[model samples]
Target chain A: MFRILKKSLKTGVATGRHPQATQSSEPLTPEAHKKASAFNRSLAIREVDTGSCNACEVEMNALTNPVYDAERFGIHIAASPRHADALVVTGPVTVNMARALKDVYKQTPDPKLVIALGDCAIDCGAFKGSYAVTGPVDRHIPVDVRIPGCPPRPADILKALTDIQERP
Target chain B: MAETKSCDTELKTAFPSIVQRDTTQREFSHFFVAKDLLPTIARHLHTQPGLHGRLALLWAVDNRPARNTYELHYLFTLEPSHRWVLLSTELAKDDRVFPSITPHIHAAQWYEREIRDMFGLIPQGHPDLRRLVRHEHWPQGAHPLKKDFPWDRALGRQQGEHRFHRIEGEGVFEVPVGPIHAGIIEPGHFRFSVAGEPIMQLELHHFWTHRGVEKLFEQQPLAAAVPLAERVSGDTTFGHSLAYCQAVESLRHLDVPRRGRYLRSLFLELERLHNHLGDVGAICNDTAYALPHAHCSRMKEQIMQLNDRLTGSRFLRGLNRVGGVALDLTAAQLAEIAAEIDRMEQDFSELESIIAHNASLIDRLEATGVLTERTAWDHAVVGVVGRASGLDQDLRRDRPFAAYDELSVKVVHYRYGDVRARMRVRMDEIHESMRLIREIRLRIPQGPVAVESSPRAQAGEWALSAVEGWRGEILYMVMAGDNETIQRCKVRDPSFVNWPAIQWAVIGNIIPDFPLINKSFNLSYAGNDL
Candidate 1:
């Protein structure tokens, strides 16, 4: 119990793939606490491809497509482990991919949140029984949230991030 | 094409190695003597004039406690008439050395290597039988596919077993990529021999994830193999389930109701439709075509909900039991799926037009990773990979099973044999899936999705089931209800034969388009790595 409590305080927020984007939306000074509260919406997300059906990556590709314009919200794939505040993973956490998934978690810098998209990543959805898999991402890495589906809808993926902060 | 023609029992009779002639689920399979006939059968099958496009999946299956014989099963497909066959011959428990088939069927090259690493079934005559999936230092004598090989072993498998002769040639610096890759893909070790841009040779190292799922299933009950089947590939979930169900039904001698079969087909198409949509977008994203990549992926992502409606799980995991589907969609849900599919089909057409005229994208895909028709055929490839190479071998059309027996689904083939051809196949398949969905939605007969599938089975029972999944012919060969547990089950995926072709395709291609062309065939590393 103490370890969980201690670890919670030690962990930090996940950083986005493009750390530069976070600079633009920096929080106002302490003097502007009320204004910061008024800022209403800023989505901080972590994208993971748990063992991946690769369907997650396929739909993830759409986030940046011209029509959806993912960059408009500064949504980007996490560049490295150190900066991520929320981890969004696609795919089922394949056994071979288990170590990398854990490594990504260890590198997430702290207080990391994970959003597991697609069925495979959730519980080893499809690739569950094969000789090579060990997961649904949560087994190897702690998944805070799960977005089930072969590949969850992009709108839901977007909403998952926003919903996290809105939660009581 | 299958007009009263039957599998010439001659092959089985002549090769006394066929320990069993299995036809549990209407799938005809002959287990070959793997130790002696591996090379002979490979050569014999390839030489048969009528069996030009016949492909075999080379992998050893796990048979628990029946310890005297280690079964190495090879699954073969006869094209046009998708008659499937299995060859299971026993090898002495310790005498793992076997003749290689790689020389005859290029597809068996990697399959043999994977078998060698996992089952300790050494393909003696194989030309380049290097370490395929396991790491260089992975221990000797601890093959995971063996029944006694425990998953909980602390030290795991020991190290420093096999040594390789790394070339010491001039100016040939090797650029190693994965076990981990830059983009979001499976774990594989690709050792590229580069001489400035043009790749001299490519060596693909796999097996970072070897769970011996087939071995684990030998002790599991027939119904328990469902989750194991799903793990064949994270992306290709329903495909594996369809094949597993086929195998189980064959063992039980049960033909699923037409309603259940139609439901199975519905989930299968949904699996295919969403995968292609994601692939089209992913390939574009990999090549910097941001717009189409993202848009297509977004639409593809919505498919999860459709799957959730149809099957409780997004990837349709656990939806397929031994005899039929596990759950049924409500009337409203079915209607919702039909409506969503219509919307998706409309969006895909518009998406297709945008990608078709994108000349910059065309240049990136057209000639990249060109696997000639000859090479593709020589490898005995399947699914979109074979279709893209002018081989119109769709298991659905070639070997009719379940609802496919009634649907006249077109098998789209392209002779170009390039990245574009593969992408074209996926695009056309998505379009075809849209048609299939409309038909299923209109004709879906309401009935029980699943019936009783007793775990118990009679002795001397073996079954083989094959399905044309999104990737290709996904196969399941098993001895079921035997001792109330699977005596042996082999989940042979199309990726076993297709991964090597992707390795061969990258030979003359530039490094940049590697991701684009690699995604063309989109073979599952997890599937193969397993």
Candidate 2:
């Protein structure tokens, strides 16, 4: 127990001041960034994997780790869609999961934001032309932001979440 | 050479008139069996003491325009010798009905269902012929894997209710969980028939994320299919891609450089290390032990960052190509990796000891979800889950591939067949993988990382490649088309075989313990569903 505490202390604060750091830098859209930063202090997110390779899910999970520490930004992954302020979805929206994705979006309260993470969710990525894919997340639900990469880095995911908060 | 000849002679003598043609490949023996004698031969091979055969995979291909028959392939691994024998039979396209091997070999159940769903091939005596990959809403007789079905054709969604088996008892209640889970995990429906807390039956409905991976492979060039293979299961990215690359390389008879082989082996071990570490921690998390989980997650993140440094992707994606790997590690990077592994080993040992000494954690893990040897063997579960159940099958050691043949791999096994045994197997494997990575780094061969070769289209040839992925044996059977394109690529992720074993594992266990047991196995939903 002593060793764990010692190690924890030695590791120091692993959390980064991502939002504040981004705000200090020259933003491409300063007005939009200012609006998003002023609106909310904390955001509750519900992660929904409509259809993903799981690589995206891994990066998202890493956001909660001590290194990224998304909780430091008042970003908590909620247990249910009903309790969420935003829905972070991944995958290309597979055929079987299309209805479930819509249901999750509908279940979330009004004034909820839907953020699409990963290339699959953004534009169907590598799984575009296959029969099982029902196009990207935007085909089913309105997406506020689309984070693109085969799987965007954890830092990128955090930035996207923060950027989404800036949206009017 | 003598053993191969003798085996050929033995097969020829046994079958004589039944065996149409026999061709020996790099890894397996392929025999074209007479169509009518498939069931008899399959049954004989499985039950015979000399053969000690276990069905590894069963799949079918549509050879239309080129041939008027649907070619069915049955791959069986002969025990004791650990040699693979590929048996194939051609069913007339007009009359696409073949005797099901599921009646005798229990593992053929899902394969038969899949064959029926994919190619419209009727497995004559399959006991449960329900849809495997295609959901209940799929239009009848609309088999997607057939050559006639266009790869990009989108069909309208049809509505139909799937009938699940219900247990009839005084107080039996059914609890259906997911297609959408509560946590940040993939989708798969689990229906538990329970009386109070104890589970009477467990039925799984997966394939929610099946993106027609095999069909997608058909549309891609042989070289371009590696990315598709990598995404088959996100965690087993390297394993699946390596297997796919090996299959393509073997089919074209392209030789990979010695250094490339060593690198492939190193990356595979690294992949195993990170996945096993995460699994060990996740299993603990299920039991309400947060400390170990947090520490393990930290360790896993470090490994992920290391992977990002080594390769471009955190999951080690885009490293595998057709003939060999796309990336090569310099001596400095290799040295850094070796040192990092050493530090990881020390940290992991400390974390494991703490978890080991915890009585409450051990209580939740030991004998929580025991998968008996009988059930494991029946399902032919591979990887850590199989090793935990006394199955003692590791493809890396038994059927050596890449640089594994050069290196001595210590296969880890435990006879307990419980959650604790599974965890122990993973822990032991992590140590073994660390040793392997160190050895590979120290003694990596000097050569080009990849061979420069332009492989042309080879018609009427197929090859099977099996890699011991973190989860288990990831098998890829690739058949070449007329223009350097994949005609049919059948992927059998370890989860495909092991998912059924979960039902048996959760037989008498309580509903609350289900998540813990499931985590212990940690079967990939996307892999299985694909």
Candidate 3:
């Protein structure tokens, strides 16, 4: 325990400043700002993997790690969709998962925003023409935001989350 | 090489009628066998003292319009000699039936079920004929892998329900979990039949992430398949791509430059380092030991950032190409990698000491989810999961690939297959991976990183490639088509075999500890589903 504490002190704060504050900031539209107001500065996200390769999920997990520390921004991954303010969906909606994705979206409380978390989720990405895929996340549910990368990096994810909610 | 020659002679003597199919690839020996004799051959290979074969992969290819037959290929990795034997059999297109070898081999159960699902090929007398990859919503009689089926054809959902294997008793009740999990993870359903605290039986229904990857491979050129392969399982991006590249390279007999081989091996080890660090932390996090988890996560991020600096993709995507690696490391870059590894190693030792001193953390890990050696062998489990259960197999040493033959790889194994054993294996392998990275840096030769060659895969030719991913062994079998396209590309992720073994391991263990045990194995659902 002493060794752990010593190591922790030596390492110091690993988390970086929110990338949104440092990176370019586009003016938010009034309509978009109204939607952002619903989150009330604190966002509870319920992540749904419709048919991802799991790279997005890895980055999502990294969001909670010491370096990213997503919780510092008042963002927490909720245990259930019912408690969530936003639905973070990844992957090209596979046929098997389309129904489940819809069910989770329905379970989320009203005024909930759906954010497509990766390239696959946004536009089916590399898996565009496959028969098993039911197109991207928007094909199954109404997507309010799209963070595009093969998997959007943790900093990008953090920036997007920050952009989605109104600044304090 | 001598051992392989003798093994070939032994097989020829055992089955005089067996037709040997010659190939330039030295890693595998192929043969055409009669359909009726396949099970007998499998039994002989599995039990015979001279050839203790492990059933590595079994996949079927549809040959319609061109030929009136479907081809079934069974790949076996032979122990002691470190060679692979591939047995092929042809079934008439009209009569798409073959004897199921699962009764004799046990390891061929999922493979047979998968073949039955994808190709509509019935395995005669198989115990479970239920769909493996095809879920409840998939329309009946629609086999996605058949050559006749269009890649972009649309089909409507049909009404059906998945039947979970039940444990019927007075106190038994089923607790079903996800195709959507609580945590940030992939989608898969788990049905736990529990009596009070202990689990009586566990049935896993995976493949929710099935994007028909194999079918998609046939729709594109050889060059485009690398990106598709990289996403076969997101975490195993390098492993899957490397296996696909190796298979393509073997098809053209293309030799990667010496420096390319060293760089590829180095990246492979780097992949291992990041994943192992994450897993060690994850297992601890599940046990509520947040200190090691936090430190390990920080270390993992460092490696990932290093990967981004070198390859532009944090997951090392686009690093592997058809003939060789796409990126070459400079001396300064090599030195940077070495320095980072040095710091990581020092930090990891301190973290290990912290974990070792925590008796409560060890208490939760020890003997929690035990997978016996017999069960692991029967299931043909690969990689760290198999090593923890005393399988004594590591493909880097058994059948060397890349620069592995040039550099000696120390295989790590443990006897008591439990959570603790799995953790120890990962920790030990972290050290081993770092050592390999150091060795590659020191002795890396000066040469072109890649070769200039037209990757025109010959028609009617196929080759198998395997890589030891951090999770386990990733295998890819590619058959080329007429227009330099893929006819059939079969991907067998370690998760596919290791996933079933988890069911066996979870038996008698309580509900809460499932996450820790599952994290220890950390099988990929997307990899298995694809």
Task: Highest lDDT: give the candidate number.
Answer: 3
Candidate 1, residue B227: the lDDT equals 75
Model 1 TM-score is 0.81
Candidate 3 deviant stretches above 4 angstroms: A17-29
For candidate 3, give the lDDT of residue B519. 95
TM-score against native, each model: 0.81, 0.95, 0.98
lDDT of each: 0.67, 0.85, 0.90
List the pairs of residues colliding in candidate 2. A36-A166, A51-A91
- lDDT computed for candidate 1: 0.67
Candidate 2 chain B: 10-residue stretch with minimal lDDT: B18-27
Q: Which residue runs of candidate 1 sit more than 4 Å off their true CA positions? A: A1-75, A82-168, B1-38, B61-64, B157-170, B310-312, B330-335, B481-483
* Cα error, candidate 3, residue B331 (Å): 0.7
What is candidate 3's lDDT per residue for B1-530, written digit by digit as tens? 78888888888899988899887887679989999998888888898988999999999989875787999999998977768999999997598889999988889999999999899999998999889999978998889999888998886898999988877989899999998999999999999999999998999999899899999999888777899999999899999999999999988879999999899899999999999999999999999988889999999999998998888889999989988999888999999999999999999999999999999999999999999999999999999999999999988888789999899999989999999999999999999999999999999999899997675778979888999999889999999998888999999999999999999999999999999999999999999999
Question: Across all candidates, what is each one's fraction of true contacts kept?
Answer: 0.23, 0.63, 0.81
On TM-score, the candidate that comes out on top is: 3
lDDT of 1 at B376: 85
| Candidate 2 TM-score over all chains jointly | 0.95
